[model samples]
Target: MSRCVLLRCAAAAAVVAATLVAAACGGDDTPTDVVLVTHDSFAVSKAVKQAFERESGLTLRILQGGDANEVLNRSLLTAGDPQGDVVFGIDDSVLSRAVGGDLLEEYRSPELSTVEPDFANPDPHVTPIDHGEVCLNVDRRWFASRHVPPPKTLADLILDRYRNLLVVENPATSSPGLAFLLATVATYGDPGWQTYWRGLRANGVRVVDGWEEAYTQQFSGASGSPGKRPIVVSYASSPAAEVIFASKPLATAPTAAVEEGCYRQVEYAGVLRGAHNEDGARKLIDFMLSERFQADVPGSMFVYPVRAGVPLPEAFAKHAIVPRDPLQLPAAQVDANRDRWVARWTEIVVR
Candidate 1:
């Protein structure tokens, strides 16, 4: 294995994010200390953080690192001792494992009314915070230049002309990577996904470690120079992000999403089981699901708001689309099959 491959296989480090605590000012015991544990993708502006603090009287400290599974694993493995007051960014793919650890405190926020029932944590162990669409992304200019129509379906990718033009992140180490793998499972049931993957392997596919490398290193549109690969396994909103981050603003993005096989990934937030302050922790969870926080999701986390009626920013609103019939698998079922899926996927495609 190459050095990069070994790095991708290494166990993820524990991530810590956001701290809040109760601080005494004058005679009132104000809620001041609250710790938020999240992955590196989680983001919030200073103004938003200040709004949360003013609204709830809590000081925030964010500790962050690792993939979603490792974050949840570190939380579960040390459940007896515990770290941080709340945990966010556990997607449904790993939802079952987080629940299995019994490290979640139940606080069925009335906010469940605002979230889609399918994504709501029925056990009340966690609350869906936001969602993202895992879709195939293509470099519009690259394909247009080659006169090769961008693939509209996953199967279209196996055409001889398109060999090695697609890049996928390794599922074991990246959060979106896991979602993309689950998407295939949802689209092609049981052993069917393995068959589909074998066909792709015969066509020659490229796999990377994470979205950062896939998008920035491998995707032709974002590599700062032309890349050999044009398609990537990434969030649907990446095209818009590319436009926003470009050196010269383009009227339209150079990339687009193939929604046919897209997967819906719902991110969740919850109070860690051994939280020091249940009251403050519940308040934090509620805060995340509130309208103000939902409105902040797009720019804050580059994810769609879970709560209905939250208007998105122009950049995202213009390019991102929620796919119809986007693939979904039950969290419990995913938890049960995760290890098997990885083994089968690696067996078929990692050669």
Candidate 2:
């Protein structure tokens, strides 16, 4: 099926499920199953799900609610009659809104003790599962063939030499785009971010709607067909993913992330406020933070585990460079100013 058709079908299913959940909330027909509502990117091994169900004695259901923003918005809209028992993929960019809306029930997991102290939940409403860096991925061959040096910093993107060589996702539509925008805001501050974006626009930076198009279609690094743009806004782990998914295993990645422009994104999972199976929801959250799940994270999700001592896949350890000081804005600041920033960004960059 076509991608648009698939998205439409998924959306229709979500709406129908939401209606059923609303009816269940109004009546006595509470669901016995523990439903996990998450973004399209969420994944877990079948073994993991089976183990959770076997131990918890509750049927597990997963709902892919479009994207991170969509999933969070759906949970907020259905706060008291949530479509699922647990919600995952709420990142730092949207966490404050979820907390402020009272969409989640506070349940601190005991498994958190093994997670890194830096990622510890400051608020009990949500628990961090995995983290990744949003950064610029460069096509090594693209620059090497031309004997041109790759841009090293955000400032380098707007240089005359780099014109028409970069592609970025739309902040209003793409998670990585939003994260990258936030990175600029954190790096350059409010007024400077607008200036930087204007410079990029003048330098011929192309903006696409989402990561898949930006990476697979426009990015010369990954596109199997003829591609133009050499630099794409993507994940630090993207290089590792390229190596892991290659048809014939690659000794090294063809793409590399520019660590200087990286933005840290931490994804969280929380029990919905009025879930039918709160105990099971809590168990699911705990399981996500467990060693077994953390071990599965790198290969399955291409993200770093939040658990302190979990070993990374060899591909990630060798190819991905975790930024020592990734740019980040406070959750409250992002929550308060996100819409305005996105709007201004649209005006400057998209228009």
**Global fold similarity of model 1 (TM-score):** 0.89
Output the lDDT of residue 276, model 1: 63
Give all candidate RMSDs, comma-separated.
Answer: 9.0, 7.4
TM-score of 2: 0.90
Q: Kindly list the per-residue Cα lDDT of model 1 for residues 2-59, writing each as its tens digit.
A: 9887765562321111121213222244445678888878898888888889987777
- Residue by residue across 1-351, what tens digits does model 2's lDDT show? 999999999999999998877664444555556889999998889998888888877678999969899988878989989988899999999999999999999989999889998897557899999999999999998899999999999999989999999999999999999999999999899889999999999999999999989999999999383668999999999999988888897887999999997999999999999888888899889988988899999988899999998999899999988898888889999999999999999999877
The CA lDDT of each predicted structure is 0.81, 0.90
Q: Give the number of the best model, judged by TM-score.
A: 2
Clashing pairs in model 2, backbone N/Cα/C closer than 3 A: none
Once fitted onto the true fold, the runs of candidate 1 whose alpha carbons sit more than 4 angstroms away are: 1-31, 116-121, 223-226
- The ten-residue window of minimal lDDT in model 2 covers 23-32
The candidate that wins on lDDT is 2
